[model samples]
Target chain A: MSNNISLWLRYKAKLVVTNVSWGLLTFSSRYRAGMLLLFLGLTLALFQSGNPRFLSYRMVSTILAQCAEVGLMSLGMSIAWMLNGIDLSVNDLANLSALIVAMFLRSIFRPTNETVLLICSLAIALTIGLAGGALNGLLIGYLNIPPILTTLGTMSLFRGISMGLTEGKTISRLPSALAVFGRTTVLAIPTPFVILLLSCLFMYYLFSFTTYGFKTKMTGLNPKAAFFAGVHTKRAVFTGYIFSGLLASLAGIIIIGRTLSVAYEYGTQTYIIFALLVLNLAGIKPGSYDVLALLVAVVLLQTLATGFYSKFLTLQGGPFFNLFLWGLVLVVVLALSRAMERWVSTRS
Target chain B: MKLTRLLRHEVVLCLFCVFVVLSIGSINPAFFSLATIFEVIRGAIPYMLMGLGVMPVMLTGEIDISFVAIAASASLATHNVLIRHLRYQGGLAGYLLIGLPMGAFLGAIVGAVSVFSGLPLFPVSLGFWLMLYGFNLFFISPEMRFDLPPGLTGFYRRFLVTVKDPVVGETGLHLAIVYVLVVGALLAIILRYSTFGRGLYISGGNKDVAIRSGYKLGKLLIVAMTLNGGLAAFAGILQCAFKRFFDPILFRGAELFVIAACVVGGVAIGGGRGSVPGVLAGVFFVQLITRGLVYLGIKPVWHQFVLGSILLGFIVFITTRQKLWVIFGRRKR
Candidate 1:
């Protein structure tokens, strides 16, 4: 038993050393600069607000809850972008999955059997997501439609189907059981935040330790070369889109759970922008640490949002103000990061 | 044989448009009425203008998805200036002057940014799109609606020509139709016969070759985007005149539809291989599909699904056909 304990300790030491070096290598100067800016912005926001509520536990939970869906979608988007493709249909897919599940739950099951309804709805939502993603993969990988155009077409198609299914209405009266995943607190953290954290951990492992992840990176860097080097480029691209679709579905479930209703237009305007913002904040680099950077970006954005709302509670056109600030932040960060990258390259 | 030679994608599109119209007419004769025809033509004007505007940019192997936002902003600018009765006495000319220049300037800024940043036009335009959308939402009240000035309204509503029909009463061709024809003809001349047009084709076909041939790529991109922005603004102004109102949500998601029309018209998204006529036909085709659905009594909710399917179908057909051609060419060689 002592020998086994010693072996475990040695293994843990090796893991720590490897993880540290990997973090150091991936956390380039650009990422450091981004993190600095993030913290600085947070500090400014906190100072300007001068409200103790800024750092309150409830506020922290709200920010985390608010960012959960966007954070999840951003991870999927980063993967798709790393494959040199993008999934514009992600927002629509999320809406569609939620709508499908909601419609199923409302139409087929009795309210008494809440647990069964939840399980079946989730299972069906995941199936739809897989099918939708696989279709995108087939079109992009096998048929060679440009990713943007394909996603654009699919976005419209998905939204249209959702609209037709729901008849331009919202599906509400979802089972109360979904609230456990969407709205409840788990160990003092919001349930959605927990789900996001779990997803990030899984993503880190998948992208860091898996051969498929290596192949995906290879394909993104150079598809022809990767193919020549025996990487199945098409398969990698296919799986990347499928993974994005699955994550989007998960996000949809969380959204439906939180709101207790599903609408065709839900997340239509915000998810794509938020995902792109997170990707941009991470400098569009593909790596395990990008997941962490995404979480930080989400936190920073959510704080800014909540702070703006609190400070200007009486302001007219609150939505407009928030949107303007989001846009401003996105542009500044993107421009700054681009400048930093150029500066770093010159110095090197 | 000569007729067959001339019957390419544009001709095919024309034929398709005719087929759709006739089919709809068969189902509901009211669809063939002169008023319906004019309505379809008027409805297609904005999309056609956008398609024409984006064609050159797409020809130069770049894209500007911010055109819709630019249009919305331009319209708002015109509305604001005209409503405030700002310093300009030319009425319609004054509004056009304000709107068009603002759009051109924005387009130039987008072009310069894309060139300087070394980023693809997609993300840069997307950023601008978000910014402009936010700006529009912030400044423009959702309730703000404006009627055109009396002089401009008269001119906008003036009939260039009138056609009499006993079945559907009298229908007059509006000045908007004239504007579309004039702009379309002008763009056709510029695209097909001008040296700049040839430059666009060359640059889009092969950037390195164009550079080797002494073309200034950055300048060309700026020019293309500027022209695109100007036309988009014009479309917005016309839309305001036609609808006689300004809504912040007007023309939302129009950029994608305009791009779709261009693509369906056989304008290669990769650039260098399309025509003004093809784009016009594409605009008509898309309008016809939507209008025909209404005529056929199909639920309007299916409109988007059908349009998307058509777009995907065309893309698949074109790509597979190209691949097959390459394969066959290799075999022959």
Candidate 2:
């Protein structure tokens, strides 16, 4: 027993000394994430200095409310990204799901049974979401279409269906009770924020503790290797897309709650860009996605957006400035993180 | 076998086009005119050019979304130079001449960023897409300009052929058809006949094989991007000329649409196995499907749905036949 214990201790010592080296830069992605956090703090401070109202509780609440849709979409995007794939159809899919839910809710004139209607609409949203995701999964997994191409086709398809159904008309004034998710607050935190928290925790638990999560990560890392090791790669891909679809659909529901209206072109072109930017900044990967980092990234984006809108609406071409900066930041962050990795690797 | 080999997707497209035209003609004899066909082809020029621009990049086995940004910036910059600064718009020649190199330069920057950042070309291009568009809009010009230079004025009516219709006044083939034909032929020659173009095919088909055979992928990447940028600029300029105005948001949401149309035209998604004519036909296929709906009394809003469904179904059909065949054969065995 003494010899075995020493062997284990020496093995751990070797791992610590020669392998990991117990340094901060060893995990460069985490280091980059930390740097991003520092940058966010500095930005908040700078923006606050520029305008004292930038750090108010009301501002924080609004930021939380606004980030809910994009945060959820990014969560869906992260799942697709894990399989070395993308779901470009997320925004459109979410819009379509939201529009369907609105159409369903709008048909009922009397809201005597508000909770039942909301529940039924939610069921409809989940069904549409899962169906949409399943289609994507089938094409990608069974038909072997490229993920980008698959999602691209589906994105337009969803957009078309919405347009065909509504003839480009916006469904306005969804049942007031339906928009409750956008309105109500529990302890000063908005309902949307609560939903976002639930989603993050759900994803975290699903990813860290579930067999589905294991399969997804394994399949993402290497489908061929996973298959050899008795993993059902295709099923994993299918289920992963289903979850993505589910998340996007939920985002669509929240958008309806916030705006109480649904249009075929809700998120449009820039929505996907923002979600992708969030994922890239968070350094999201298949096996080791940091949920906290993702949350921070979403909050950071909302803060910047709110700051720009409130403080600099008149300067530097307004919202386009944010887009420009995000683009620059994407390039800069990717380059910096990679360089940091190289530097750290070459150092010791 | 060789004769049947000639009867591939393009041949199928020709038949499909014929079927659509005839069926629509039967429904509305007024729509059966050759003039409408000419109009469809003419309208497809901008899309064709965009498709052509991305073809070379796709041939290098990389997807590029940055060309949209390049086109936006190049044309907008050129417009700013000609309209805002120089105020000299003598003719179409000046626009093309200035915009071509501007686009190529922008495209080369995309290639360089991909190379230097050591990231996959997709994400690098995505970054450039957002960065360049936002940069141009914020720093360059946000408001669209409807005023045209004196030379480009009335250029929208310069049809090569005109036919008087009792109902529709006059519809004619646009003179821009020459541009498409010329550009298509040039690209075909480059892709099929040139040794350098052959390098695209090799590398796109299989990267490792190309490397083993000693093709400089980095150089190819840059050159292909440059070619793409130049073509995109040309398309942007042409679109502006045809539309009779310059807009900051020109081609704002056309990236995915153009890519999808090209893929439907039989440009393989993973690259290395398509032709210039094939891409043109793809664009034509898409144009007919979307535009022909109006003639068929289908609401225009349903056009997106048609396009999406066709794209999805076609991709699955094109890619899955062999897989299905293999599965069936295994079952039989």
Candidate 3:
């Protein structure tokens, strides 16, 4: 038995470990970022191959807009994930924020003073989002409720409030001023895309350069340990949730500006799953994630979604087939990442 | 000792059930009838089965959101193959035979992947959840399939026990409730009497102890997941049969909903504790609130809010009881 075991280990268990491919594929952040970009380019090319229109400047603009919505969501999701928690209510909170702002704007019945209306809308959306996040933080951090359960309850709660306020009616025909985020582009860049870029940068700075961020990471990694280390873990957690809420609310504002409407049913739950997929695709871990990778993932997903909506695979179930492909992509990404990690470990 | 045991999670849920029933009954005195009880049971059949199906996986201390995916794909596949493809005119037996194994097979695939990949259960299951649903949409018909084979046409109206209601005239308990009873009793028995069941608890509660106790930890985990997947699929198929149609998006956002229901039933989220009774009471409680709202004339918008608030309050109460006792009771550790 010992001889057989030794023989099997020697031959059957042999792994073809090499650092050459590993170096380019995943050795450093720079290489990994490049790899992700190359992969993104490849996906774009493949979809373009199916339809020439898919690669057009018009398509890129649409992709950027879609990317902003998903990008902001993933960023919000990333914050919760960083704290070793999840924010299932982000999309719901976004919708609710937008709804509140819409209700405010609609009650005024105003088309006058566009600047003031936009500012008030922005303030309402952000404040509502912050309050919602505070509620989540109180439950999860101060009260010691599990993040998932708390968020799950809040997910429905926020949407319920939105629905109750609206009586399940969509608020449309908003003041053109409220649609500033969706309408205006700075230097040929969509305003939503600009918002996404600024948010990403701000979040990156927060995570990388702040003591609070460090504390948050430690708290998420091991709450007891962080607490014992005098990290004020509850505060870190509370703050983290607050930030996620803010991010989600921003996404809501973008949606309102872009669509010029708000409703309880907006964003839907698919946005939650898609945001999660972006996190997964970006290879996020607690306390550590690549913001650029997140952006790339959002763009990639948007392209895929657009392609499907445009019937890229018309021969094979058309638009509906996109879901299957998304699922497949999730599985394949997991497998490939695992393989990469395994290869790295076998190097020793 | 019995009284002390009764003070646990399930008992609290039972009390909550009474509270809900009394409040809802006050709002609509008509809700105090046996017909409504039978109706609630009929509506909760799928929910109960799903609760029962998911319990083992949770007991093993691992979350499996993929079970819904398992259900969607398996039921869709069964319908497509048996009804759409073969045009079989057989009864529920043909559907079950095809679906149960197919569900089990899909579950086994989940098990095999989780065991092989050695990733965290949540993410693996999450991946499968998306994969299976997408697969169902991509490969199976994306549209809702209302065309039930001749055998299933009568299945929707089929009931085990009929009742005479004063107002509605005729009402009956659904036949699918049998699945819940059979599954619940069987699961209850298995969880209590079997070594495999004990192994799940042992492993979930403590991996090192489980390893030392002669349990095949890897194999046991896989089996638990498979059972969960298979049961979820079964629940889905039953629900589809009863609804008389199949949709690709059936239970799309229900992952959290189902898990929240199961966890509320006193199943320890970290594993090692749960009961069939607890699960049943949990589902009954949630389903009552869901169905009872329509009768209360409170408008559909407020229903979700009320449910969320009540659910939140319940969890808060559960998590804070010890603290509350410390505050109000004799304050000593």
For candidate 1, report its TM-score.
0.91
- Writing each residue's lDDT as its tens digit, candidate 1 over B135-223 gives 78887754557655665665545666777776546667776777778988998898789878888999999999999988998888889
lDDT of 2 by residue, A184-297 (tens): 788889999899999999999999888889889999999999999999999999999999999999999899889989999996767787788788778786666778788888
TM-score of chain A of each: 0.86, 0.88, 0.88
lDDT of 1 by residue, A1-348 (tens): 999999999999999997775554356554654664667476656645697556677777888898889888888888889988788898899899998888777777655676776778789888888988998999998887878888888888898899888888888887788887688999899999998999999988888788988888888888988999999888988998998999889889899889999999997856787788778766666433456777777777666666777766777876776666666666666666676666667645
Worst 10 residues of 2 chain B by lDDT: B1-10
For each candidate in the order shown, give its overall lDDT on alpha carbons.
0.80, 0.84, 0.81
Candidate 3: true interface contacts recovered = 0.62
For the record, the alpha-carbon RMSD of candidate 2 to the native fold, in angstroms, is: 6.4
Per-residue lDDT of model 3, residues B1-333, tens digit only: 354466888888899899989999998898888888888887778778788888888887777788888888888998899876788888788878888888888887877777776665766677778778777887887889998888888886787788889865678888887778888999888888999999988988998999998998779878887777678778888888878899787777677667767877887776888899998988888888887898787788787787778677767876787587567545442
Order the candidates by DockQ, highest first — what do you get?
Answer: 2, 3, 1
lDDT of 3 by residue, A238-263 (tens): 98899999999999999999999888
RMSD list, candidates in order: 8.9, 6.4, 4.3
**Model 2 regions more than 4 Å off:** A1-24, A31-36, A108-111, A342-348, B1-4, B324-333
Structure candidate 2, residue pairs in collision: B265-B282
Question: Residue-pair clashes per candidate, as listed?
Answer: 0, 1, 1
